[model samples]
Target: MVDGTKKQSLTDNTIGALLMLNASKHGSEIALREKERGIWKETTWAEYAEEVVACAAGLEKIGVKPGKAVLILGDNRARLYGGMLAISMLGAFAMPAYPGATLDELKHFLGEVEIVAAIAEDQEQVDKILELKEAGAKGIDHIIYDEARGLGFYEIDGLMSWDHLIEVGTHDLNEAPGRRDEILHRSKPEDPAIFLHSSGTTGKPKGIVLSQKNVFAAAKNGHDAGAYGEAEEILAYLPMAWVGDYAITVAAALLYRFTVNVPERQETVVRDMREIAPTFYLAAPRSWDQMLTTIQVGMEDSTRLKKWLYHFFMDRAIASETRKLNGKSGGALEPLGRLLGELLVFGPIKDQFGMSRLKNAFTGGEAIGEDTFVFYRALGIKLRQFYGQTEISAISAMQSPNEVRLHTVGKPAPGVEVKIDDSGEILLRSDSVFAGYYNKPEASAEALEDGWLRTGDAGYLEENGQLVVLGRVSEVMYTAGGERYVPNYIENRLKFSPYIKDAAVVGAGLDELTAMVCVDFEAVGHWAEVNGVPYVSYSDLSQRDEVAALLHEAFQRVNKAVTEPLRLQRFVSLPKEFDPDDGEITRTRKLRRKVVQERYADVIAALYDGSKEVHVSAQVTYETGEVGKVERSLPIREV
Candidate 1:
């Protein structure tokens, strides 16, 4: 970690100044790209500067000023970045709300701060604000929209198109050419630059206040660490509200002068990724799991010879990669096996997943299964994990390739100090620590004690300085017999099976542990087809004797490897997957343990009672805003 004095030295560079520096150094280089209608549109650094300047001027025309809060809700796009920078230029706080936020979540965010104006991505976002206004939400006086589709007829007051706002700013710029520059020059590094809302897996979301210096320092450390370079490109596919996107996509791009590519649509991201093939990449555990499932499912339909060849090389690659992860020279066969595997198996897999050019591939947000982690590494991808939180600008410890370990999140990041309390809670002291939570001084004080930020995560530092993060302190469960265990660790092991999409370990005060599992719809469905089993829906498939047999086999394998009191006694597959929209998980894809426990109380009781099956009639919401009941008698299987 850098000394405190060195950390303080970086507290002078505001995000706006960093963008200006990039513009000055590489004015003609492409700084951003957005895929539209299957084509990439580039924006030079000079164009980036001009767009931000115009956006700042436009926002000023709408009465947004220094100290005001400006909310941006959208997918990752060029305009969202411009809007954020424009807010920073005016010394206003840039708050990005998740595009998928529920109406209640949006209302809470709106009520947290004095949001004077907001820049939304399209008509859908505009309608959300309009609905809130109609429902008595106030404080937002202006709304600027980027996409005009399905919004041509809305005659709402204070609603303006992004193009029109830019035009207004251009008119103002024509009158006073240096007005935008003047505002940016007056900005201070200590001023609050952005407000990131926590994922709120535990409770209501807190508005995390991040100063310009904090954002810059975090990104600068990553830049200095050589995580990415000026020539490196990354896909901005993650949600814009996420702190990692702000640090990796916005601040890092400005500091390193790299290109940020925004995908056209979230559904099309994987296909577009194949075309862009970015050099730098980061994804949550769910995404990685989904990619692996896709590959496995696709292979199920391949010819017998092809399947034989894939398994042959895949086994060799795993053997070779396992040695590298353990910091050992493998058996003599490993070297040749890795060579043949890379030439025949790993190379093709990497190319198909659009990771052939990936340099700094990272997985975070949750502990990825060791099997999942090894699969990517075995396929010759530089997949590593990092440990972080929203309050620390999203980076605390990151994996370094040379000293990487599958079980650890590598060493602490540059300029970051990590310490574990007696309670095993990880504490971080860094220049990039957030200033405070908005309007929550008492909570802020509890989180930030002295110079350290209490991360709320239970973890320990290895002798070699790598950080091994367990699950959240509050989420770790203890049995009636006083045996303590981390649920996610066990759940991750179960989820390592390709058939399982998600699993919630339910033990707490119970005598033995059981899991509520959600099957991977595609993977399990294909398995049933290949095995000549017939099923109509998820509920039907989950109850099939054949499906239970498959899960029982997987559970028995996991149970055999389970150590001591944490062993799984039984598990039941749920008829439906956990949905964020249903409040079972957070928007960031984190399971809300309390909610899950309460929602599945019946299933838990049935499992403990040794019931053969529990009849369930649950309400489910469809994509078209219709609600329906799904009834089934899901089987409970004992390992």
Candidate 2:
């Protein structure tokens, strides 16, 4: 285990104070940019700080005080970011909720803290807050909304517009010149700056409180380790509720003085990203997989000559990358061939994905598929994996440029110490580690022992100091034959095939393994069209005889790589995709194993009872907040 004592001095600066410092030192530098109506708008550091001061003063006028919590519901926007810093300026915790959270989920978060005010991004967010208030949620006395287009007609008692709030704040600030500096200095390093929650993959989400010190320490460590550099360009598109987004876009951006760019809308993220061509980027594995699928599908429709060139070049490039990853040198002509391929094929692909300027890109939150990892590297993108949790300010270990590996999550991050316990759980100690879970002494005690945070994940340190994560310790399972395995490992391999989007491996004490798969509707649908197959809907297309044959071939290929006892014996393609609103997956796309097993108990029993088909009538939630039932008879296939 590495010692945590070899560390730099911890700074006493809060996030609000950092903003003030940046404004004074780099007043003319662009701190933020956002697209609106096909135009890019910029905010300088000075303006950003000024806006935060106004927002804090306005919030104080609406009963905001130190120790009170403020709800921030929205997509990534300059005003939303300013409002978050403004809350910190007042020494209040900024509680950001996922924009797509269901009303019930929002209610749970609201019940956890004493929220005095809220900042809503648009009319949709405002409506959810109004519904909660109508249902008798207390402590929320003011609602400040950014967009006023669809909300001008609302005649609510505590509702206000973003512009009006700023106007009031400016007036209040001008009344007392000394108040600006006083508000900027209100927060200290020990004060809680933000409130986050666990992903809830195992159960209900737990509230986590992080102080300014924790956020800054984590950001500083990443900067010191060369994760990001000063004035780097970054695209802020991930859900703000996730720790990854907050750590990089807000904390790190402020600390390193990077430019944070926000997309115009969710649908225009790709176009905006291409326009920005950010220097650094990070995304979950699912997103990387989707991009890969897009490229593959696009190539399928290209000219015959283009398709041939793609295969010829991609094959050689992947081979060369494989050798390098294994610490081997390539042929003398390999560099020339790579240059030619880049000009003809790979270069265009990178430009299309807006990764041409991505000097550093990362994938985390779960294990990435091997093919996906190698494909990007072969295309000349520096895609690496990192392992982290929300409790450790979102990161603890990450792959350096020189030590990239397929199975390990690189070495411990700067100033962070890692060790394994007797039970094989990974333990981490860092200045960035959170104090405890909010209002849950028992859970906090179980998570934090001494100064080390119990990650609850099973992993080990390599001889060279790299960390290899197997899976969640609690998720390890044994078969009736006494063979041990982690379902996620096999599941990730299954999803390596573009045809399969999600999979669940089940066989805790059974004779053999089985899987329930969700086919990628777009990828499979395109394949069906090209192969002259007919389908009416996702449900009908998934169970087609020809599609079953295709999946069987893919499954056979995966089975060839595993031990005979661990090979999947039976599989079923579900009629629908896993939806977060349905409680099948978390917002970050992690599977809810307990929920899935409980809901599919009947199907699991049928798989072991020699049944050829299982009838399913499941309730699904729609994006419109409506619940409906889907009934289908899924045919079980043998590998």
After superposition on all CA atoms, what RMSD does each candidate show versus the true structure?
2.9, 2.9
Candidate 2, residue 303: lDDT: 97
Q: What is the alpha-carbon lDDT of model 1 when measured against the actual structure? A: 0.83
Candidate 2, residue 294: CA error in Å? 1.6
lDDT of 1 at 149: 94
lDDT of 2 at 351: 94
Off-target runs (Cα >4 Å) in candidate 2 are 1-10
What clash count goes with each model? 0, 0
lDDT by residue for model 1 (247-347), tens: 88887777666688989989889998988889999998778978987898777678888788899988777777787777777776777877877777778
Q: Write the per-residue lDDT of candidate 2 for residues 1-639, one digit (tens) a residue.
A: 011442434345677778887898888999999998899999999999998899999999998887788999999887888888889878888999999888788878877878998999999999889888888878778999988889878998889998999999999999999999999888888888789999999888999988888988888778776688888999999999999999999988887888999999988998899899999999988789889988988998999999999999999999988898899999999989999999999999989888889988999987787788999999999898888899999878899986899989988889799999999999999989999999999999999999999998998999999999988898899999998888988887788787888888999998899999989998899889989999999889999989988788778877997899999999988889888999999987888988898988888888899999999977788777889988899988898
- Please report the candidate that would top lDDT against the real structure: 2
TM-score of each: 0.94, 0.96
